[model samples]
Target: MSLTWAPALERPDLLAEPVRHALEAMASDGADVAAVEVTEIDPDHADTAVLVEATGWDLRDMANCIVISGARAGEERVCAALVLGHTRADVNKAVRKRLDVRKCSFMPMDEAVGRSGMEYGGITPVGVPSGWPVLVDARVVQREHIVIGSGLRRSKLRLPGALAARLPGAEVVEDLALEPPT
Candidate 1:
């Protein structure tokens, strides 16, 4: 379906380099996905809350990609956790248990941006480090298509939710996020 929200990923200018590269790689392997850049926003204000309000997008159609790390002695093991914007990742319970670690927390902003090679507030699951799991909430894939960060604050990705489920080292976990109180 042609999307009125954003244009095709055929033009590299429409997406961040990393995101375009990731999408190109996916397309080369025959995965279908698309992305678009949103004009008139300060990159520093690209967090989910800001983007959602700025673009007038439905919260349920969007998900936040957060880099989280587990406690380890020598080296930290980090994973990209994707959860619906309306809910929060279950870091203390679900994530810690899933990672099999005593404690887990959101990666420091500097480290997350540095290691992921993506801008802060614009981290996406497409090009995460190899072997790092992309834990996607089950609710995410149930949607036909969803919006995600583009590894750059200027743009966003619209793609089949199942594509996230198929990303490298992806783990589709139930209740990865805890819903907010009604």
Candidate 2:
């Protein structure tokens, strides 16, 4: 599949409201949001497995964003973890340690969707709520370009890994994710 990537700002219809707003904000801040590209596809192929098979893209170049919630001393903490599709977030050890919480787990799907204002299976860290930490696995930042959700099921976004690391509140966390054991 030869995907034609257009500047995301030129295709607001392909982006969810929050995603469009977030990209616009980034552009205003001189963040070079133009480097972001958007491409539309069948909603059924929005998932990582189907998308990779359909596009022939390497799984390592696809970024998966997961929301996690936990509490430390009764103070709630929620963050988004960005990992490559080939790995899983280390929610039990790495994430809990990062959040300084006794325990942390994936946030409920409905709550994550509602809080992010993005559709489930299509949430990206680009537009997470203010104050929410976005822990990006260090490996994701090493990719030349990473494919991520467009905050909607009908489209996807591609941008330089360095640009992703620059998203507001995003932090590159070493070993934030781990490849599954064979």
Candidate 3:
């Protein structure tokens, strides 16, 4: 399927408020705004698997941002972990270790969507709450271009993998994802 790409800044309607603000902030920080683009998509195809089948895009070029939460000593910690569409976040190990919490689990869908201000199935690391750590799997950062959510199910964002690593509060974490069994 051919997709029409437009500069995300010029198509603010395609982005959630926080996502637009985050991209603008990155531009002000001297990041190349031209590197970010948005494309319209069927909301029904927002999930990674459906999107891959609908768009014929390589799954490896897609990134999935998963929200995870944990608590320790009465302190709650939340993080967004970016992994390749084909892999799973190691929430029980790598993520837990990084959050310094005894255990971590995927945040409930309602809470994740409500807290991030992004639609469920359309959450991206770009606009998660400023305090939440945006942990990126090392493999994701190596891709030249990665497709991620635009914070709206009707659209998607494409940007350099390096740019994803530069989002506010983003931290590159090695082995943050586990390969699925064959």
TM-score of each: 0.87, 0.97, 0.98
Residue-level lDDT of model 3, residues 28-117, one tens digit each, is 989897899999999999999999998899999999999999999999999999999999999989999999999889999999999999
Candidate 1's displacement at residue 180, Å, is: 0.3
**Candidate 2: tens digits of C-alpha lDDT, residues 15-47:** 989889999999999999989999998899999
For candidate 2, the TM-score is: 0.97
**Weakest 10 consecutive residues of candidate 3 by summed lDDT:** 25-34
How should the candidates be ordered by TM-score, best one leading? 3, 2, 1
Candidate 1 per-residue lDDT, tens place, 56-141, comes to 87898888999999866766778899998898999999898888888889999999988888888779987887878999999998
Backbone collisions counted per model: 0, 0, 0
TM-score of 3: 0.98
Position 174, candidate 1: lDDT: 99
lDDT of 1: 0.78
